[model samples]
Target: MGGNGKFSRWKISFHRAPSAAKKEPPQEFLCPISNSLMFDPAIVSSGQTFERACVDICRDLKFAPTLSDGSKPDFSTVIPNLALKKAILGWCSKTGSGHPSPPDNSEIESTIRSLSGSGGTLESPKIRVSEKELLKGVTETPPILLSHAATELNSRDLNLSSSSEESVIANSTPLLPFATRPSCFSYSSSPSTSSEFVAEEGSRNTASINSSSEDENFITKMRSLDVYEQEQAVIQLRKKTRTSEEARAALCSERLLLALKQLLNSRYTALQTNAAAAMVNLSLEKGNKVKIVRAGMVPPLIDILKSGYEESREHAAGAIFSLALEDDNKTAIGVLGALPPLLHELRSGTRRSRHDSALALYHLTLVQSNRAKVIRLGAAAALLGLLKDRDLAARVVLTVCNLAACDEGRAALLDVNAVDCLVGLLRNRAEFSSESTRENCVAALHSLSDRSLRFKGLARDTGAAEVLMDVVKADSERAREKARRILEGLRGPETAEDGEVDWEAVMKGGVTQARHRVGKSSNRNSTEF
Candidate 1:
């Protein structure tokens, strides 16, 4: 009995012990379905046996086995779980030595029956073992079972004769029970107790799967909704207008003019034009004069007047006209360097552009500096050219009248022959039939005549006195009033009282007549040699 015990131990050691020639650890099996270390392996009635489905699953998932080659198998092209099938088939062919051929569909059942007992009774029939029990008897149970499972599945489709099956079964040996626990294999045999655990696990998986998809759908819906809302908002804003209070507020804002200047560079032409137009309209408002000058927008506007598109030039001209009505902006007009381009526009631009240019120039000349620049830029000739245009002539005449009201501007005007131009425009009544044109011309001449006694003689020599007389004969009250004032100023001292010129009589009798009478009286008082 002692020798038998020693022999049995030796046989177990020979079958179970690792070979010294094996440099790498043995391969393990993984379950194809669960993708985990195979456990609770069992032989089913369908002629198939899985020793470690869990280990086979792990191998299929590319996990390391308890005793596997250090180098990983190339799995780039391997389908998921294919490693399990390959492991199972290879294991079966090597393990089953030479047992007689089992029935094709009953190999697992027959093997189980042989291992437990051959009796046809419930107690004799083989009992299925859990993965924990199978691991207890094998040193490398995880890898061995995994390899066996992979080998079986992979070889199932291959031709295998009964003799080969017998050979494999006869050579097969049961693995001895291991002394230590298998490191890479484990199993839970506890029966499930509650439905909530299953439901919770399933819900977690479903939530994870749908999270990205749900977020994408939400973002798509929000973007579509935002696009519609933004378009509607733009349309509604366009339809709204500034209230009276808002207009007042804009007039008060120092940034209003600056903001309009910046809009001149807008990519949208319509927006640029609209902003410029709004600025022009704003400048025309009562009490908004200070805002226009203090905004430091005058220079850019003048630049626009000189070089911007047609619409911008018109708007800039209008703004200048509004600012010119104020004494402050009038002085700054020359600093604007706007006279040259303004005169050019007045002479050659479209009717609206020309008109605005003339108006702006008219306002600018009301200031001394502006009058100087006008003379420097040859505006005298430009103004003279407009004498042929009755409408332009009237505007020019009114602006000249205002300029001649100041001493410095009057001198500058006379220096540029502006008085002579006015005289010529007045005498050319054939070209100016409009009552307003003739009236403005007469008023301008009268203002010139009132500047000095010498201007009275000059006016008469230029035939301005006759033009005033013709205007006085006209039926229009304004024409007669302007013509009468011009004639009175031309009459000179006869229209003076208490060292103050009789402004009422001069306005009524015309400065031309007043200056003419003064010139005759002065000649008489001088007495010839």
Candidate 2:
């Protein structure tokens, strides 16, 4: 009786131990479905565990989980395997590695679903993940399930027998889990919770994900394509990015801007134009301007202005115009020898390119260092030529006026016959120009004729006397005041007091017929010059 009882106890203990050990997961912790390490293992109704995302995908597909023993188990009922999840958390914390949070069963089930045939084949026509969904930060494609689907399709196409198909599926393994994927790839699991955690932690990090995903996808597409395809991709990227300010800001990374700089060098016209357009948009952010300039963008932009298509020239000039908004870029552009090409565009490019080039030079010349370079580069002739067109008169005149502030620029303008052009425009102000033009023209004359009797005489020869008298009657107080000063300087004390001519008497004499000429060597303050 004692031996019989002992034997029964021993037999019961032996049977229970093997059964429990069998139910325990392998020491390596492989997902039952994907046959990969279960980063976040979860249990389902069949009393088996798989990676959270992997098995949830399986359940969504109504696919049975293939067990370790080469048998299929029902996975209809899903539950988080808390014990396994805790283990994974512990391991990651202990190793100081970041583990991706698990996928939310409810959210995952709604956003994405796999379509598998009765024979377990995946169909074509993949559903695209929307940007809004991506921003929520929890959505990802189920690569493991997709891998299984692909294996199933391949098996079906080969006309494998049921047993052979099972063998193939069993041996197939998906790539690494999301947590283990290369740093370049990102997926959001358990989005609502992760987002809340991220928000509580600070949502600023989420903005990086937006840029990262876009940058990664763009780089991948760009690297895989030929030049023509890259051009098309660049055009599409520009189109998509232009519509979103956040996208523009997000794309303002050093790596991507360098790619754009390289694109600017492409011989393909479309690529050159599109790359210029993209740089224009990206440079809208002040921070990106410095990055773009440092990436050696100016020289290529100058190249584009020199030889690119008309639209490319316009965009490239416009990009430089935008970049020149940064003071640092202004100096850099001038140093990179951009003035010659820019001046060429101002003289001969399309109207848009001409205006854009002028705009760029306008900003670049704002730096004192660049002012001398622009004047040295012969901007005076080009600008004076454009000034004749009434539509471009104000901008051209304003830029010339600014340039004329420096001695070298004033001397350059006088040498290029800018005085005659400016005086002609001033004389025809009411017919072809605005009050601002009158003021700037007066300022240009002031800068040019202040110390040089030759420029003053040149102005007088071009009917400066009549133009100044008419300007004195102008409604703009600044214009009226400026015109009077020039008229006084042009009128000699032969009319009255030391330097004060009678303006009332001068007006009575009729400005067109008036000859108000100050002494050639008048004693006006040279310091004012």
Candidate 3:
């Protein structure tokens, strides 16, 4: 019996009817340009087979061979076969036809059933299933034997039954219930032998079971005990901050100051400018005026004022202006000697920075200890130079006039012939079109008149007297009042009766007293030129 069993197994394995061999391995083909496999096959006008089709067949066969030798099979044998030729011709004809007909509803349903499954569970809901009715007519019979009986019954009854009765019989008959029906039986319309149905059902069930088992195995492998815990640990780690205090300490440390100094010395203009401004803001907030003054920032600020970058120079001048306000910082600012540079900035810097520097100088000059130092540093000459700047010219004139109103500042300013510069600016104001310039010029002359009658004589000598007379007659009341005062100073009793201006007597009586008297009716009426 063992020998017989082995013989049977051997016969089944080796002597079984031979299946047809797969077609020959595809040919090797190359592209002319790249000398590599042709990527996509195409037919051209040439009669001979080109590289493309052969290359594609070879590429597919390289990974998966239709034959077992691991070599590309000869394509010519397959290409000439009648069945393959017919299939190829049919595909080409369908593709080349102008418009292919769409599949009928039955064909579409068959294709969907083949792909999804013959089970009613897999079938779409649009195709109705009468499960209870089908089972009721089954009569407790086996499906294969019952289907044959049903076929025989259907044929035999055709002769006796009327068409309506046949329809009723067809409706009442149940060939198979959905769950018990073999997949192949559900697809086959002809109720014949059940062997083919069993074979197809076995194949489909085998594939579905194998695929489900693989999916379950893969899902089981992917699940891990520590995954959630590890993810939570990562999130917790990200939330922790160990170096926040260290980072803040580094920013405010002396290293930051050194970095700032290096940045100020950087070759890049933008870096230098930005670092300088940042340092200025930080120092101003911290009141570290001494650090700024000692770091030689003043000279660089003056240099920046001379440069073309207006914004940098403006901020630099502003920083210096703040420093100049502090009495303790005055000596340091004076040591770096900002007055000369500030004066230069006032003369040559952008209009905004020039005005700022002028205001700073004005404040600096107010410090009695620095007043002599400013004059000695040629600040007077620098302010006189700014009289030519269109924006700052009027401002410079005004500042000088205010300084001249001070006895000591006025004395120092006069020593530099600052009066001559003022008179020159007044003479230049006549040609300007801006009313502000004209008004400022008049006001400066008025301030000068409030200083000394000699300034009044100087105003008259420079034709400022005529300019004031014009302003007095103008419609603006402020201009009129300003002009009226200057006129009285020039023609008032402060002048000698002999028509000579007594600057010495006016200086002795004080300019404020003379200004008060000039507004009086007695001084205006009784006094003569």
TM-score of each: 0.44, 0.55, 0.39
Q: Report the lDDT tens digits of candidate 2 across residue range 111-182.
A: 334323344343422222233543343223222111110011111111111111121122112221122110
Q: For model 3, where is the 10-residue window of minimal lDDT?
A: 235-244
Alpha-carbon lDDT, every model:
0.45, 0.58, 0.42
Q: Which portions of model 1 miss their true places by more than 4 Å?
A: 1-260, 266-268, 326-328, 415-420, 451-457, 475-529
User: What C-alpha root-mean-square deviation, in Å, does candidate 3 show against the real structure?
Assistant: 46.4
lDDT of 3 by residue, 426-497 (tens): 455444434444555566556656748566545544555544545655424555677666655665554334
Best by lDDT: 2
For model 2, give the RMSD to the true fold.
Answer: 29.5
Give candidate 2's whole-model lDDT: 0.58
* Candidate 2 off by > 4 Å: 1-209, 492-501, 507-529
Q: Which ten residues in a row have the lowest lDDT in candidate 2?
A: 145-154
